[model samples]
Target: MSTPQEEQARRNAAVLQAIGAQQPAQPEWPAQPQPPQEGDLWVPPLGPAAIDPTATAEEGAGKLSLAFWVLPDAVFGMILALALQVIALFGFMAAQGLKTQEDIQSLQFDPTFTLIAAPTLGIGFATMAVMRIRLLRKLPWSWFGLHLRTIGPALGWGTVAGFAFLAINFASGLIFERLGSTPDQAEQIIGPFRSASSLQLGLLGLFIVVVGPFLEELFFRGYVLRAIRQRLGATWGIVLSGALFAAPHALSITTGFIGLLAPIFIGGLILGYVYQRTGNLWSCVLAHSINNLVGFLGLLAALSLP
Candidate 1:
């Protein structure tokens, strides 16, 4: 009884109803952007590709290429540190009226050289390291293992590990001394500690316990080691990092009685491992601070002894 047009309209409506019944319901809200899948390279807002959180083991090996890792963080860092140290050294010499090379050599044993020069070098190293990581890597400071959540645990473990290392070092030194294999490097290094004024001592302690550790751990473990680990895997990364850590202290090896290279190398390995395990910079820094603290206390105690 319906008109032809009405019949066609009804048929169309029925067809549409059947299609709607088969189709899935629309989401109430707009769909969120999907996260990058595993094996996907993450392009940072700036710079080249950044770290992939879910990268496969093989892909991760080349996540940080050698050119980027070594040039900015390692080589440039060393250059910056050296340049700053040279400036500091010259300034110190000028202030003290030291003209000859011999005069500078003598001043090396002075508190100003140890306290001021060493800290200046550390400042330069740390500043350059931070700049490189932030600018070149296009990453935040937090990427360098600066998370607040891991601080307490990192510090606690670091303290324990540091004291243990000190004990081992002490025992090794005693054994070497008994065997007449050790030299008289302690006097050369610690002599300044004995003669320094209370103010100087305090400054030196501050550098050793806080500034030095923070800077060193931030660079060596946070940046260099992390990069190497990402590329070369843990074993090579830890070893190479420790070697680099020890390399700077090479001069001390010639002067110290027991030679600091082995202990420092071992310490570097331990610190690198701790950082790798915890992914926390504070842990290594605290550990380094504790190690320095023990040495500081020992120097104080020795001075106090009659």
Candidate 2:
């Protein structure tokens, strides 16, 4: 071993040698965030995505924000509309002096169907107004995809979707029929028009082909769809919205036939999908109109039969 002074001299020499050596360069990181790399999974945000405050235009209401209003609005809108319909029908029956049950039972539904458009229109207008008013969080109508900017896609894609839905619905109907199901709901729909007056037929046709579809799209594909989509995400949103739409038809007067629900549900899904992709309320409306037009023409054919 060296002496203590020799050890100290060696350590000092080594330290001086290290200080004179050059260091390797440090890496310079990129300033901006890098793109997602391969094999990366997208983790969803922790909770309802907040609307960006700095955004130039209205984004949309978060799912949590809408949870309180969606169910109530749907229920109230339907109940109010239905109540109006019943009241109108009763008033008409009283006006006609049809005291007998037989006379009331024999009353045709073409006028009733045509009249339903009035109350439905009122409800729709109210909904639109309420949703757009700034006091109530002022949900932008455009956020619900109710805009004319995408008119072409809305019309073209929607019409194609409607036709496709009809074909698929027909095939599904046959399947149900094969399984001992009856098309009772389908028949009931055309039942009113069977012996309807010319003027009443024209009015009913207008309602089903135009007004009905527009309003239905405005509700189902518009507000209902967006609300559900916000909470459940796109897939479940489409599913539940469609299911909710088909549920109301469980009434005997409507296509309450269990077998018919499949087609109706599928139609709802198509409408939801179209609305989602096109982001245009009128697109879904036009698509719905196509389906209605076809059905209306078929109703005319049945009425023409001897």
Candidate 3:
């Protein structure tokens, strides 16, 4: 209804009012404050997990980097010592002329049992000594799990297997007697076969129960079996070690023939299997002890029979 100029002035004023309403009075910023460079913002670069580079597979189970730990070195050292022991045994046997029946019987006076024990113990000591060397060098004996838990099973199974071995021997002896075949005497067989006084028997039993098992387990199952397993496959390791185990019995003149060899071979197989399964020496030791005990007990029973 107003004049044209008045109408134009009103429209312009309304446009100005709308523009003023849309324009912000001051700039708004993000709600979060910027992180401090020294505190929260500094993220260091991450590399691979901390592990030694020289370790074997057995040494680096869950490690990020493969590294040589102390255990493998110690174990290798033990193998070296055992190899040396075998050579020494061969040398000594050759020197003593322990080939024929007379030579073997004569040498029994200076028992291989006593001599072999020294080298076996030395191997164990040397392995532990090598581990100490690693420790001094500030290397990883840290990762080695000295599992005492495996002892129980080792002892239990070793005893059982040992008893089984004795049973086999007794049965074999009976079969030989029935067939009118003279049994060849093996060292272990003779060692237990010869009956001294009751005191002597008791002492021998003690040795069988304790020392024999410990020594055999250490040398055969613990060191020999484990080392061979590392090189050969486990089956080969068990078989070869078992054969080697029977070699000591070759000293027996009367009973060391093919007949006795069968049982010894079979016994070795059982023992080697036990050692492989347990990963502990105690089981083999216990099994060996129990086997000897069974033999001793059986002998006494036979002697006492009316």
Best of the candidates, TM-score: 2
- Give one digit per residue, the lDDT tens place, for model 1 in 1-306: 999999998888789898875445676998776787898755544322233242132222234464255435565666777787788788888888999989988876788787766765566557766776676556667777898876777777777778767876777677766766664445555766667889988887888778888988887887777766656567777888888777766544355534466677888888888887777788888888888888877777777766
**Shift of residue 133 alpha carbon in model 2, Å:** 7.0
Candidate with more favorable, higher lDDT: 1 or 3: 1
Candidate 2, poorest ten consecutive residues by summed lDDT: 50-59
Report, for every candidate in turn, its global Cα lDDT versus the true structure. 0.71, 0.68, 0.57
User: Per-residue alpha-carbon lDDT of model 2 for 48-138, expressed as tens digits?
Assistant: 3332211223324433345345667777777776777677667776777777878766664544544553545446434643563333655
Ranking by TM-score: 2, 1, 3
Off by over 4 Å in 2: 1-26, 33-64, 108-135, 252-256
User: Between 1 and 3, whose TM-score is larger?
Assistant: 1
Q: Residues 1-306, candidate 3, lDDT per residue (tens digit)?
A: 799999998888789898875533587777865554764433223321112121233322333221223235445655766777667666777876667677545544443433443345445534553343343333333222125776666567767777778777777777766766544453444453354456655655666567656655555555455545544457876887687667655544555266666677788888888766766666666667777677667656764555
Candidate 3 or 2, higher TM-score: 2
Off by over 4 Å in 1: 1-68, 71-75, 100-105, 178-185, 256-258
> Residue 244 of model 2: what lDDT?
72
